[model samples]
Target: MVNKILCATRNGIGGEIVQVQANFVRALPAFVITGLANSSIQESKQRIQSALHHIGFHFPALKIAINLAPADLAKSGSHFDLPIALLIALHKKGIDTQEWFAFGELALDGTLTYNDNIYPLLLEIALRHQNAKVILPTSGQELFCHLPHLQIYYASSLQEALQILESPESTPAKTQTTLNFDTIHIGDTDYYYEREFPLDFIEVKGQEIAKRAALIAASGFHNILYEGSPGCGKSMIAKRLRYILPPMSLEEMIESVKLQALSAQKPSYTPLRPFRSPHQSASKSSILGSATQNEAKPGEIALAHQGILFFDELPHFGKEVLESLREPLENNELVVSRVHSKISYPTAFLFVGAQNPCPCGNLLSPSKECRCTPKDISSYKSRLSEPFLDRIDLFVQMQENEQDPKPSLDSATMQQMVFHAFSAQKQRGQSRLNGKLSEREVEEICILDDATQRILLQARERFNLSHRAIQKLKKLSRTIADLDNAKDIAKSHFLEALSYRYIS
Candidate 1:
């Protein structure tokens, strides 16, 4: 008799279902597994046999052949152990297997174990197969607690799992609580907005212009650059921008959690967007992604999807790493290619770069005298090319110090403005923020007044702006208009957008 069970395996940040088919025939006592499995999967037989032995069940004398279906696809992970063991044990008893999905690693002493990586696979199963049931380890149930309308059966050991399957009707499956998206709080608590952030905007003693630019950048998801002397709060402004940005939608939250779980970290269900700040010494492969012997993994860019990628000390990063971001910044995704494979990952992040004006950090400071030579300054600035600079939406020069240090903004006040701009984008049916809008979408949504159009034309001609730069200006203008709660782009908004263009 042939017994079959459903299983799943990870593929990047997603999951693919596998059919575990077991056949028993009269022959010499032996067992084998086939179908493009990796070393970890091939080693499952030993684990399964040990677990079965501990459960008081000996392997049958007949030859057994287990095959994972879809022979062309690569399958890895120890989660296949449970399904394979279940199929073989039930085949020996002449018990037919149903369509329930099973995933867990079997211990030598018969205990089933799982980790946070199971959450991505679980999410994949829940989304693709709505009516499917699951048999998972009991310890890792928290990952699926918020998922609704799914029937999950939790088992602690191989013996307990078999007993539950034998008398399936007696063991009721655990049901997920219904998540009301419309009514559910986005953050963990109602006081989330009022709580003090670790790096609040109020902490910055001066640089009101920089804070206003930060607010605009957060409101529209714009890529911004801050050039100033040391201790000018450049990094401080970039670090706190993520908190003021709008909350994520339910679907976006699920995607973010799934991506995080791929790294084997316990995923949390919070609407706050991710804020990734990789060290300046990170390698190109670490930021863009690379293929291992068996699988390709997402890099820092993918991890920062739909979030913030703050590059402090921009010139300190490798030239290759800094330039590689150009494609993802334009396309909202990245494709990493290796010798035999290519993997694509979403990288829709708000790019915030902060850097010193020169190596001595006093080229632009009025109070500090620059001791570096002209060639030295040129070399330091040459690390960032003009093409890369053109991608930045806002370029703000922070003040050396506050002549009048009265803070004009705080996190709470700026977040309210961000919410208004976010609502405007949603009202216009835009999935992305204003700064990431396509050229065609900008033309469609940002209706410019005659005076505003005339000013833009003059600026494009006078500045020798590239076609891309013109499009970016229009997007910036649209964001400025959104912040002002205006339906159309006005002359003042166009002027504010033009003032941010990079001069060098």
Candidate 2:
């Protein structure tokens, strides 16, 4: 009789259920694992054997075959060890079978080890099988306790797991009875940073117009670009922008955590959105994700999903790396393709780029002279493609001013405005931020008044704006209207949206 056990595996940030089948045949003593499993799964034979031996169950002197059913599916990761060992143990004891989903790694001493991938896999199973019960290492119980629906059993060792399976009246797993939406509210919790961020907009002494642009970007989740002289507070404003951005909801937090769980980074339970600032020297593959052999991994853009991706010194970044962002910027997702596999990941984030107006970093400053000729400035600006610039909603040019100016909108005040805008978007049933609206959604939701339409027509005719640019302008204007809680787009909204367009 063949013994069977249930397990789960990864399929490019997604999860798939797998069946482990064990059989004892009449032949020379040998252990074999048959499937499209990689080396990580194949090496589990030794770990499983040792773990069983440590628990006083030696394999019988017979040929043992373990088949991971649906064999065509490729299996990777060390999580196969626990399920394989359980199947073999039950086979040796002539025990029939029980429907249970098991996933973990088995140490040589028969201890169950935790793997971070369980969160996503278990989440998938919970959705597909509502009454599913999963057995995992005790260390992971707290990590997934927030998922109240799934029944999760945590065990410390192989001995404990076997005892629980053998017992007729084992205690049921503990679950969270009450949701924690109100506990540790986003308004009360600090942002997810290691240390206190002492740099606030107040520290940025000048460029009042630039500060206004940053506030608007945060309120609507719009992408913004800053070009000006070095030390003109471009990067300073970008860094502080995150502090004033709105907090995430429970659903957004879960989605963001699911993406983070796919990467090697330890998952965070906080509602604070992620902030990723990849250096300009990063390769295209590193920023946009890649597939090697059969394993597909997420890149920095995917890591920054549902958060902020700030690029300082934008022109210094690789051209290919910058261009690769165009698709994700428009579609709110990234698709990475290899010779044999393709994987898609969420890339919805607020982009903030800062760069100097020219190579000399003094072209727009009145206090300094720009040594670079017009050709140098033109070439520097050309590094950012026209299509790429179109995707960005707001463009501000900053210059060094001799007079010190007081900051108008502080972080707390700006965050409140963003929070209000977020409420408006939620009431409208938009699943995404205002900046990520599709063209169809823009047409459906962004209704322009007659006066606003006239202004839009004039701007398009005078600037020779493309159809795509007009669509983007409508989305931008919609966000501006949302900020003011307006029922319709006014002339001021249309004019403000037009002012952010590219300047020749």
Alpha-carbon RMSD of each model: 3.1, 3.1
Q: What TM-score goes with each of the models? A: 0.91, 0.92
RMSD over all Cα atoms, model 2: 3.1
Model 2, range 1-504, lDDT digits (tens) per residue?
A: 888888888887778889888889999999999989889999998888899999999789999998887899888888888888888777757554447888889899999988877778887887788877677888777676766467677788888877766776766587654343333233323222212244577677767878878877877788899988888888889888877776665556667777777877788676557888999988888899887655677888998887789999999999898899999998989988777788998888999999998999988888788899989989998999988988898999887863355446666666667777766776777776678888788888888988888888988889888887888788788888888888788889888888887755
Q: Model-by-model lDDT, in order?
A: 0.81, 0.80
Tell me how far the alpha carbon of residue 118 in candidate 2 is from the true structure, in angstroms, after superposition.
2.6
Lowest lDDT 10-residue stretch of candidate 1 = 186-195
Clashes of 1: 0
Q: Cα lDDT for residue 433, model 1?
A: 84
**Which stretches of candidate 2 lie above 4 Å from their native place?**
92-98, 171-199, 402-407
**Over all chains combined, what TM-score does candidate 1 have?**
0.91
Deviation in angstroms for 262 in model 2? 2.7
